[model samples]
Target: MCGITAIYCENEELTPSLLYYSLFSLQHRGQESAGISVFKNGTIKTKKGLGLVSEVIKNSDLKNFESKCGIGHIRYSTSGSSSLENAQPFVVKSKVGTVAVAHNGNLVNHLRLRKALEAEGSIFVADSDSEIIAHIFSKSLSRKDVIGSLEVLTNLLIGSYSLVILVNDTVVAYRDPLGFRPLCLGEIENGYVVASESCAIDALEGKFLCDVKPGEAVVIKNGEMEKFKVAESKEEASCVFEYIYFARPDSIIDGISVYDARKNMGEELARESPVEADVVSAIPDSGVTAAIGFSMASKLPYTECLIKNRYVGRTFIMPKQELREVSVRLKVNPIHKNIEGKRIVLVDDSIVRGTTSKKIVDMIKKAGAKEVHMRIASPPIISPCYFGIDMKSREELIAANHSVSEIAKILGVDSLSYLSLDGLLKALKRCGRNKSYCLGCLTAKYPLSWSEDEK
Candidate 1:
């Protein structure tokens, strides 16, 4: 999914540098492109491109952007191509005023919505779900109040989205009824900040505020915040993947500790799928927590076997497949000392194509591990993600085509075990379940129907 952040302040300096720093805190969300829309004098000014946050914003560039209300985004390509127009926060010049929206997660009904708007003479710039939303709000200009029109707009749109909207004097954040993506709120000295994770807020030294609840909208204006629930409907199937994989380890989502969730996932994995091994290690980064859990549950010593390169850019589009391979190679190098002559149990989050996981298994063996057993924190991903995740087709998914044993053999792991669906549900409930969550991709269910064209 993509990451989005915005702030509204009356006393703090409205420098673009502030947006740059905040967006940099969220670079993990999107690697394809980045942009920010600044609202000043009833207009939304925007700067965007295909690059990192540091690459997109410059010293002179930030100086040109000055506004009390602003919205920023880093896009990971989902619905659109990797192009400039697809970058967000997309700004539109409407008759009522200038409106801009940056979004995370995917809209299932995007194709239908875009066609309807186009038939009604709406000129489009980018092939993106965010643009459909902006045009819908643009059509409701007669309603005047930004949030009210947006409320109406939300009802017509279907699927998962965590939206941050910017207009003159107002910065608002809205989560879809199912909350398929994570968004949080924070408070700075003189402003209110909304971001994809608490990490972004903490980066700016903002105090932790609660997550934007599913089916709710939070509006930050003139240093004040207001909340509104989605119109009377309460059924929300939030995305379950946030716990097992996605989010930053340090961030808390929906009041549940993400690290705890992962650790619990590992514990459950050990229960559902146990294997014999000498040492338990994790694929560098996200997989480490679950590995710890597995190690604790299985009573195996946990060791740091994979060391990651801190300088690697986001891993979504690596410029080329060759580049992606090199990047992964450069990012993680196995520790021969930890793995040598040992039967290693390697824990990882999820396996999409099985390419990376397979390579990792081979790397450990090459580093001197006697045996490599692969353990996945989540169940086999049989279907592609229609959400903001970059996985595109089932054809590319190894599990979708091959059975578990087949996949294990392909990866050259001694044995493989994935967390069961029951385990995932159990892991989340461990943190206390106050809200409904979406297990669409895992369960082959969705908040909205998937069109054949989308496939």
Candidate 2:
């Protein structure tokens, strides 16, 4: 997954700082790299590197980026190597003019498209799927009108994508036909903003207008906003994982509150798999809200038995297994006083490989907990996520290969229970969202057609 932001201000004063703060709010979505591009004096200038937003763009750099319109991105490398070359907002010179694009989500047909483009003499500078978008757009612009070109390009592409492009002082934001990712529009005092999540709009003190509807594009130019239907899909398949794990709890997605959805998940889990425990605790940040709901439903005392290291980023988003293990230790520590002699109910979001869950269970046991009952807020992730998430192989999923009882034994937990698929849907429905969601990773079903090998 990745985070993307764009701003178009009426006044000529630079708004790069606003982009910076917006990206900071979205830092949770990606951490490998950060970048920003500004359109100034009929030229698009970009600065990017491999690091956190703070590490990559300095205050001085923002000051130097003097422009009224700009785009920014934070990347986690779902489609390319984690390198500076793959970092965006990618600035390219198209026949129409200079354009910079920042993208979130993955293209399922990237390899085939890349080969076709290469056979036609398209020279790619970066090993990113996002670069392919730039090539297609630029090439199409050479012969077709802007809207027609975009429509054709959108039709040719498959899988999830939320894009922000800066071209000729206009900031264009578009979400794919299936709506497999989140993208929204917000209004600021002197301009408008488009971002991957609503939380970034809140961070910028902007009023959210609404979501850029599935297959819709919103263009912002000189503070005026216009909407266009670039492409259309018969069904909507917004990624449900965003509410379960990817999105910040405080954010609202597709008119549903992420925090409320998670709490409801916990409540459903409690009703489906009630456990008698002395204390109810969470696996730190992601699991805290659900644990609270579990405590309320189970009438058990809620306590912070596991204290998280505030400095450490999320371990699951880390790209490597060894790094994930090392970071897990640095990320959380058990409070012996609270855990000792206690029957603990541990609530977590999901278990992918069972590595972190095993370590956390071991840590709780070593802290003298008499028993650890694992409760996952979402259904077992038994399938790969071909859209954008990093869980790309079913072989890496422990639940895909082992039974729940076997997984419990592997983790050394007294018992394991995951929220049922029906329960998950019910919780989301309780949030009052009337939209279909993509549960491909949990259900092994996709809204869009894909090749057998791709699946």
Candidate 3:
């Protein structure tokens, strides 16, 4: 997906730095590009480019800007090619005023909608699905009814979207009816903030208020807040993968603590597949919490067998397969003392293409592990995610084509086990999430449908 942040502050000078740090907290959500759009002196000024938040926006740049309302975005393309043209916080002129939009989640109907908009002579600058929302919302603003425009905007599209739109100085935060992505509102000094996750709000030292409800829009203006039901709520399908992989452990999403959910997943996995091992180790960062829970439940000694390099970005999101392969080696290293002569139980979030998993297993074995029994916290990802996740093709997914035993052999592991779908739901239930979360990647059953043209 992507990271989006919006701030409406009485202290205009604080907006830039607040947005900058908020985006930095969410840098894991996206790494391709970073951007910000600020409303100042009756106009919107946008600065965006291809890079990390720190690489694109500097302290000097933040100090030079001043605004009462602003929005920022960090992006990694699931729908469009990675380039400056596809970067977000996309600004456009609307009938209401100057509008800037930042979106997280994919629109399954984007291609068809784009073709229709083109037939009616709407020009397009980028292939990003997010740009589609900008065009539709800009046209709907002609109705002069903000809520009514949001109603119209929601009805015409399908799939997931968590949006932060800046119409002049007003910031509107909207979550799609299915709630396939995460968005939350927080209270900052003399103003309010909306972001992709609560961690961003925490980074700004803001008090988190609540999640932006499914099918609801929260509008902030002049330091006050207003709420509206722009669309009818459907069966909630909040992305389950967020807890398993994407979100920071400290963040709470939809009342469920991400760390607790992952730990519970590890516990469930331990019950489902108890393994004989000398020590338990994690893939690092994302997998650490689960590995801890696995250790607790299985009564295995927890050890740091693999050490991650902080400098390397996530290998799964690397732009090319070749780059991903090379980065897997640079991303983590085996601690020979811990791994040598040990029967290692390796825990990780999920295996997408199986390349990185295979590489890691090989490295652990080469470091003298007697056996590497791989355990995945989530169920095998046998289907593609249409909402916002990067895995778009079933062909690219290893579990889609191979059985568990085959995959274990391919990865050079002694054995392999994935958390069952039932086990996943049960773990989430313990986190107060119930059964409403989306399991499309694991079950091949999606909340929405897509056309062949869009696919």
Predicted structure 3: lDDT: 0.91
- Candidate 2 lDDT over 276-333, as tens digits, reads 8998999989999889888888999999888999889888789888889899989989
lDDT tens per residue, model 1, 144-195? 5766776777778876789998866678888876678889988877787888
Better of 1 and 3 by lDDT: 3
**Model 3 spans with C-alpha error above 4 angstroms:** none
Candidate 1 is scored at a TM of: 0.95
Give the TM-score comparing model 2 with the true structure, all chains together: 0.98
Better TM-score candidate (1, 2): 2
Model 3, span 21-68: residue lDDT tens: 999999999999999999988978898999899999988888666898
Query: Candidate 2: worst 10 consecutive residues by lDDT?
Result: 446-455
| Top candidate when judged by lDDT against the true structure | 3
Q: Which stretches of candidate 1 lie over 4 Å from their true place?
A: 12-15, 314-323, 450-454
Cα shift from native, residue 89, model 2 (Å): 1.2
Say which prediction, candidate 2 or candidate 3, comes out ahead on lDDT: 3
